[model samples]
Target: MSEEKERQAANEWKVGPVAFISLLVAILFFSGLFMKIDGMKWLSAFDFTTLGGTFGTMKEPAKNTFLGAGGVSAKAGFLFALSLVPTVMLALGCLEIFSHYGAIRAAHKLLTPFLKPLLGIPGLTGLALITDLQSTDAGAALSKELYDQKQITKKELVIMGAWQYSGAGLINNYFAIGSALFAALTAPVIIPLVLMFVLKFVGALFVRFVLNVVYKEDFRNEQ
Candidate 1:
């Protein structure tokens, strides 16, 4: 009985059934296997086209309207929201795989030095944060996951949120619409892009100061 007890204690750190299943689910879903399997066909119910159409219809004016400004806004918002789905899935899916393989722990050790001073978040969270710069939805989703796991506190969330929203999806959105949107600005568009990146970090710092100084929420101690 003593030997059995010792073995149980030794295996305590091994990956559990739930974690294994989570990793599997992340892999299957992201790889599109779930959609292919008839048993999991229901998962594909998250139809972006239908969702976008619904939003466009709902935003149509009360009076007779055929895709006017409101409809356009709705479509744009839908597409924008849809654009984030893949990034969020891919990032979170990779996170699950990394977590299962203990890569997150390794990454945390390596990233702590740089991320500690800049983001005030755990080294493990660096993956999500970087993904946020490219896709706000992915970043925000990953942030929520980290918070739910108790890896970060509410104060840290606020700081990351500020940084994310200030200039989230910077690269994708810029290349998608920057040219036509700022045609008159010409070469000066580069200035705004650079400023946006700078301001995101600045906003993060401001939030950190507010939380650390005013609220006395010290993340260094929390970690």
Candidate 2:
């Protein structure tokens, strides 16, 4: 091969060390392999049943026999929020690694074409947005990491957060928690999930308009 050709081949972009690290982090996170690791087991130690029981068992303040409204509310709030702590911590840690390792930048260029028009955010945001549809805490945590890194502007943050709030946990919420309603009804489960997912994007458009035009926030620095 010619010298010039050899130089081009050597410099041509291929998966690098950072990309490998980022890929490993992503796989560990999404596959729940991190949770299985001995050192990381505490991250998944939270008990959903116990958290739910706190609210289920809560009652109005009564005489000495009852813990009262204050106690009930305190326990409920603490447990509910505590259940999400693991997700937030895990996502933040994994995303920081991904960001430092160049995963976000590698994904940005390819995703920009599609995500920009629909969400007014960079392509890198897709990972969090998709994860949100399964787990809201993890998604929000990832978005926060992006915002902190200044990869996304304030406007993009708000728009994406709104999208996530609307239907980010669709699969889990509908198939698991929402199964009570979906199973009892005659309607196909896909109907509500699909409807909610579409509406989420629609809501993103409105939010983008409000932030971009109404508020006049600049999101031109997306990276």
Candidate 3:
């Protein structure tokens, strides 16, 4: 490639870890983690009295119990988030283990014929793509591996990007959060559940179409 072309390629490929950190910080700020919202009372409608005792009698309990409970809840949330860190690390570790055992290679061989034609992605890309469904950072690291190994070209990476950009592992998220947190029988649950699946399917299809269009020439060459 020419120097100009190389420079352009380098400029196009950039990862902004700081941007991700900033997003987390912003979410914490807005979610009343750092500062409470003015003039907004939380859980004001909760009928604690139904459990027994008037508001005045409950004042001490509310102050002591509620505050203590709030601390526990916050700690639990923090721990939940922390728990993901190790899970993610373990996932990446497992990926490495699979790679070492030749499982990934076997999977690539088994899946290539089907995926190559339908998605225009190499069979090997499937491993990374699958991992991406579990974790974005992990998927990204796998994609970087493919790039570094010359298994996928830069142009092909762009095409893959289209498909990977949309939310992956949505089904897992739905089951983990939607079903687990809120009982499936909760009021009007079916509609939201169905809608989430539909949206995920549509989003995946849309990305496939866009990638196909964007990489039409490259795909044609492959054909």
Give the top-scoring candidate (lDDT).
Answer: 2
**lDDT tens digits by residue: candidate 1, 77-149:** 7876676577667667767765776555554655678777887866666656656655566678888998998
* Error of model 3, residue 182, in angstroms: 5.4
Give one digit per residue, the lDDT tens place, for model 2 in 1-223.
6999988855543447776567545544453323334665565433221122222333533532234434466676777677778667766666676766766655564567988988888878876876686677778888887788777888889989989999666765676678778657777768877889899999999988887777773655543
Q: Model 3 misses residue 25 by how many Å?
A: 37
Clashing residue pairs found in predicted model 2: 61-68, 61-69, 132-168, 133-168
lDDT tens digits by residue: candidate 3, 1-223:
6999999866543324443343333223212222223564452222111111122345455355433545566766776566455544654565565555454455455567976776656666766665554455556766777787787876557656655566654434444466765654656765765675455445655666875677566556532
Q: What ranking of all candidate models by lDDT puts the best one first?
A: 2, 1, 3
The TM-score that candidate 2 achieves is 0.64
Better of 2 and 3 by TM-score: 2
**Global Cα lDDT for candidate 3:** 0.53
Worst 10 residues of 1 by lDDT: 47-56
Q: Cα deviation of 137 in candidate 3 (Å)?
A: 2.6
The list of candidate 2 runs beyond 4 A from truth reads: 1-70, 73-76, 97-102, 184-187, 217-223
In terms of TM-score, which candidate is strongest? 2
Per-candidate RMSD, Å: 9.5, 7.9, 17.1
